[model samples]
Target: MSGERRESGDVRGILHPGEQARHRRLTRLTVGPALSAFADRYWVVRWDLRGRPAYRAEVLSFPCVNVTFERSDLRTGGFVNGVCTTKYVRELSGEGETFGIRFTPGGFGAFTGMDVGVLRDDSAPLAEVLPAAAGLAERVLAEPSDERRCGLIEEFFAGRGRAGDPHFALVSRIVTAMAEDPDLTRVDQVTARFGVPVRTLQRLFRRYVGAGPKWVLCRFRLQDAADRLARGDRVDLAELATDLGYFDQAHFTREFTAEIGMAPSEYARAASPGQSVAR
Candidate 1:
């Protein structure tokens, strides 16, 4: 299957677009309506390396959880990966396929009452995270059709019904606003705009999104910067920094380099077609 380019939303986190063709194909699908309240999207990744060297795909993660069913020469199982606070890396080799559910930020908390913060930077068996999903990995991996796999996922969550808690809905709205409004560079802006107190906002995020609001804001801004640079856009660094609410270019550069593993200018050049990046 050919890789589907991202249709909408920011596509910055998935790195080395030029190298994707050499290793794998990724497809993203929408969730069925009944499960849409909890899931943002379903993603399928297939790769065949055979005799070729393995490719490491690096990603900047959002404040969301991912439940995945993977079948490969390396392993076959279901895993729940919580909101990651740092760069996420995956190595593809031999041959493998994976089906994944990316829960909306704070959405997973609707299903399980556990404080999302405890799962940060951690991963666990799906059965451990959601006992209702026991054996789901085997069922999904056995299906040859992607459509059917989606159906199975929908059936699993649809039976649970909609999330009734008003807190999750409120969390979703706040998180969505943070992602969409570039001018919202400060937590106070979020508090003021949404009429949520600073402490309450932080507490809600810790329990539901697994990260603090300030961290989420910075991640979104940096993701935007990476996307622009990867597109080889001739952006003015200082201007872009100011727009992202950074005090100055130097601070922005420091943070970007630390998180993305490369300076902005270097990333821009590496993203140029035919240019290579030393990861």
Candidate 2:
């Protein structure tokens, strides 16, 4: 049987962890206290694929927004990616580098004072959201040092002169709880735990998170499952279903297939060494 895995487990959300090392390097830097209210972390991904076949990188994304600055042979620009409810995929070839800012669930909303729901499953040029940032991307992409690039990005946000949102802290706490607690499978559990009414919780999430609490909860659990299975861990499907709060194995299978695009067994097999698992 697959052992119990909690939402709080160290799952990086990379669908093909085994293959990641061969083609790319990913680094995550801490978000300083000064910017913690608005951003989660900074990530630098560098890849070199010259004379090698293109690699497909797939991720089981968390419920958060990201601002990415990419300099690649195929594309070069900065973009703001909203919450992607589904799996995220990208192809890597040639040499390239990307610096990204992962915003906290409610953090992006605090910056624009607009409902984040409109950005769900979509992305926009960074200039559109922060016109002042129009020239920031070029400067970031030109900087070779990751640390300096991060400083530039940080300075841009820190210089915005906006006050911290009281709601950002509240939302961060609630989201962190949902991600770390496996027992929080139901929305009512969240309401009870946080003492927030159902309607208020939903409204807050819609405006800030771009997705409902239930989705965030389920997504975290699903990511945990994917992380475990991709590591080739032996799992009992029924037991996993129960751990994820599914009514039955069948229900779990349906949901997994719909979101992951493959059955659990197939995914595990594909993750096996020597198997070419793309997407």
Best by TM-score: 1
lDDT at 273, model 1: 55
CA displacement after TM-score superposition, residue 239 of candidate 2 (Å): 1.1
With a 3 Å backbone cut-off (N, CA, C), the pairs that clash in candidate 1 are none
Instruction: Evaluate residue 242 in candidate 2 and report its C-alpha lDDT on the 0 to 100 scale.
Output: 87
Candidate 1 lDDT over residue span 1-279, tens digit each:
222444344466776665664578777887877668888788888998999998888888989988899988766899888898898888888999888989899888876666878889998888987888898889989899888888888888776754587989999999998888888999999999989999999999999999999999999998888887776556778887888889999999999999989887787787665333332
Q: Which pairs clash in the backbone of model 2?
A: 2-236
Global lDDT of each candidate: 0.83, 0.80
lDDT of 2 at 62: 87
Q: How far is candidate 1 from the true structure (C-alpha RMSD, Å)?
A: 3.4
Q: Could you list the CA RMSD of all candidates, in the order they appear? A: 3.4, 5.9
